[model samples]
Target: MAKEKSVYVCSNCGQESPKWIGKCPGCGEWNTYVEEIIRKESGPKKVSTGMESVKTRPITLNEIEAADEPRIDMYDEELNRVLGGGLVQGSLVLIGGEPGIGKSTLVLQTVLRIPEKRILYVSGEESARQLKLRADRLGSASGECLIVCETSLEQIYVHIKNTRPDLVIIDSIQTISTEILESSPGSVAQVRECSASILRFAKESHTPVILIGHINKEGSIAGPKVLEHIVDAVLQFEGDQHYMYRILRSIKNRFGSTAELGIYEMRQDGLRQVNNPSELLLSQDHEGMSGVAIASAIEALGLF
Candidate 1:
């Protein structure tokens, strides 16, 4: 067994320090350092995953196949448009937003509409009963959606292997932890390690994983900067809690354009996709009003 020692690590950049400091030298953020336990082993320890062993080898550019990657339709036109038509296979997508901003509702409602695919919805923040209640309110529940309230990373992989789902969803990355690391869940080290492991699993098994993450005080994803770099795409769910309209903006997308956006309206029955903004943005009362001029402009893969 290896000996353990505690070290201060910055939550913003994953920088290590011998002791606590007021500001993070790596990211220049204040009060972002947290102590984490490290094992003094001879070399790095490998994370055990349920994915099949498929060794990768480098190949010449000419030998590689140049075919269009397959995509999974989310069934929501707004989400599909923002994801550059549809979600790509083997892609790891990270969705971040403020709490109570309808992140879970949007994902649950969308997945429920896809009855053909088998989806594994794992939640660490909410219980299975809570998710079921939300699903009941959302109304469709047509797909073969399995819900599990778990936080252990190893257990999650076990569930993945047993279920072999077509799509996997992690409610929030902050709450999931792995036994490989002694750091608590939501720590910088845990978030980085878990996300990297999930990304590897997604690629190796050719299964898409959607990770919902929390935002920090600065409004960025509550994890190290490398977390964003590990995923294939980063999407931001933005809107005020008091408002009915919400926006989904693509911050980074390796397979498609990042300028696209998705809009949804929050209602009592669930989230309703807004296919056309003209109907909501422009009202009959606004017609023939002074200082009102309608013009055509392209934004978020649509004409407005």
Candidate 2:
């Protein structure tokens, strides 16, 4: 029989507590403690993550072949530029945005446009038929793109191993759950465990995993703050739904600088990438436009 342990965790800082309290001792947040159940094993029980063990063996630097890492062209100029010249293999990317913010549209349009890579899109929020309908409206039902409606994290890995897709995209990470964890889905423990599992697999198989995440009312990524630390890159999609343009900004990137940004225009036929965003932002009709000025940054040399 497995033993159970109960602990209160602060949602803000992920600080563990033995008893319930009005304020969190770690982050000083009030009434943020939530009880979480953890199953403890006797005699050092073996842990099974369902799809197979994610454990990896350490390798020496000399063992690896030194060469420039290969990248996959996404076929979109704006996306390529923001991703630091295409997506890198074995990298985990997190795309977070508000509800109805075109996060799904951007990803579906991208995978459908790229026919070179075998893509597996796992949707926990929508059915496969719904995804197909959306694809039809996007004007491309490429045979290269496959959709599976599943919420079980373990089953997702099973399909991945069988299909052996070169690229994998999860519609929303919040909906996926793992049986290895005792807490409910979307909980702090579940989110961290699931993300860690996916990260390990991506590194071991040399495949890229793109996760769609939800944002809170505070305009920050939902769930534990540690989720952002586990991913290789965190890309934020922001813009008002009423606006015609959307911006994709890189908040954190391990392989490249975070100053890169991508712009897209939402249209009836899916998203259209803005090749030169500067031209669009700069007004062409300068006549009768008061207070419109163009300024350029100048660097000056100074003695150290």
Candidate 3:
């Protein structure tokens, strides 16, 4: 067994310190340091030794196949458009947003929409009953979708192996923890490890994964900066809590372009995809207004 020591870590930048400090030297955030236990395992650690020798083959560019990657459509045109037609297989996607901004609802609705695929919906933040209630409210109950309220990373992987789901949905990455790490859930180390594990699973199994994550006070995903690099996609759920409108934008995408955007309207049933958001702005009442000059533009988006 190896000895463990306590170290202060900055929650913002994931910087380590020997002792607690008022501000983080890496990020300059005040009172962001928290003590975390780090263990030094008694084993020869692997470093960048040297590249292993292996048989390799080189193919010309003309010999490479040229075809579109497979995609799983969410059935919602707005969401599908934003995702560059649909979700790519073997991709790890991260969704982040502010609290009470309908991130969970959007994901749940999307999962429900795609009943053709078997998805394992893992939640650490909500009970099974609560999720069922939300699903009921959204009018989306799929026999193919399995819901599990779990927080252990290892257990989740075990379940994934047993179920062999076509897609996996993690409610929030910050709430899950691994057994090997002594640090608490949502810690910098735990978040980083869990995400890497999931990413590995996604790639190995050729299964797509969607991870819901909490945004920090800076409006970025809460975790190490490397977490974003590990995933195949990073999407943001942007919306004002006071309004019913929501926007989904891709910050990064490995399979598609990031210029697309998705718009949704929050209703009692669920999130309704707004295929043409400009239609809502045109009204009979607006036609008679003096200041309203109906300038012709493509798709009515020139109103800005």
Candidate 4:
């Protein structure tokens, strides 16, 4: 049997050290070191026999075929416009917002609107009954949507493999933990590992994933910097809790433009998409109002 190896790793920069240090030399962060156990293996792990592996062939640039892939159509036109048309397969999206900013409500509404696709919504914070109550209140009773209340990444993967859903939504990434790491949930290590695993699954299965993440007191995603880099897109839901209007902004997009924005209005039923945004911004009630001017803004994809 091989002895287990242990090392202290900096939580900020992932630098390994023989012993705990008060300050991380790599990132210059103080008191960010944490000890982790490293298991020793005798040989390389065996590959699974379920899937057959194929070799790749190198081809010339001219021989490669290029075509514009169509995006998935959604019932919400405003959301489709903001996503640069619609959602793309095998894309990983990260959505973050403040508490009670209507992040969950926005995603739940989207899921309800898309009835053609099979969606798997995994909640780590809420129970199935709680989600059903919210869905009922929002009038979102869909037969195609599956709800699973789980916090373990391993169990989540198992459900994904069995269900084979077209879309997957993680309510909040901070609450999910992985078995590979010994740290608790919401830790830097656990967050990175869990997100990477989900990203891999989405890519390999050619399924789109929407990950809802919690922001820290600093209003940033509560994870390492690499978590943002691993995903294909990052969206932020911003608005005051007291305000009736909410904004969904794309910060990073690999398949589309990031300048697009989606606006929604909070109501007793649910989030209502603002189709004619200009009308809402400039109304007849605001006529003759000083210092207010109406300007025409053109969108790239002819949405406006």
RMSD of each: 6.0, 7.1, 5.1, 6.7
Which structure among the candidates has the greatest TM-score? 1
lDDT ranking from best candidate downward: 1, 2, 3, 4
Cα lDDT for residue 30, candidate 1: 97
The number of clashing residue pairs in each candidate reads 0, 0, 0, 0
Ranking, TM-score, top scorer first:
1, 2, 3, 4
CA lDDT, every model vs. true structure: 0.90, 0.88, 0.88, 0.84
lDDT of 1 by residue, 14-117 (tens): 88999999998778989988888987776677977957766686799999999988999999898988888889999999999999999999888988888689
Evaluation by TM-score, superior candidate among 1 and 3 = 1
Worst 10 residues of 3 by lDDT: 295-304
Relative to the true structure, candidate 1 reaches a TM of: 0.88
The better-scoring model by lDDT among 1 and 4 is 1
| Model 4 stretches astray by more than 4 angstroms | 1-37, 41-54, 283-304
Query: Which lDDT tens digits does candidate 3 get at residues 138-206?
Result: 987799999999999999988998998999999899999998889989988899889999998888789
Residue pairs with clashing backbones, model 4: none
Q: Candidate 2: what lDDT?
A: 0.88
Write one digit per residue (lDDT tens) for candidate 4, span 1-304. Answer: 5457778877666778989999999989898788877656667779788567656667999999997755777678776766778888888899999988988888898898787789999999899998988898899778899999999999998998899898999989999998767678887778778888889888888899999987777777767767788999898888778778888888898888888988889999889988778767676776567997677673455556
Name the lDDT value of residue 15 in candidate 4: 76
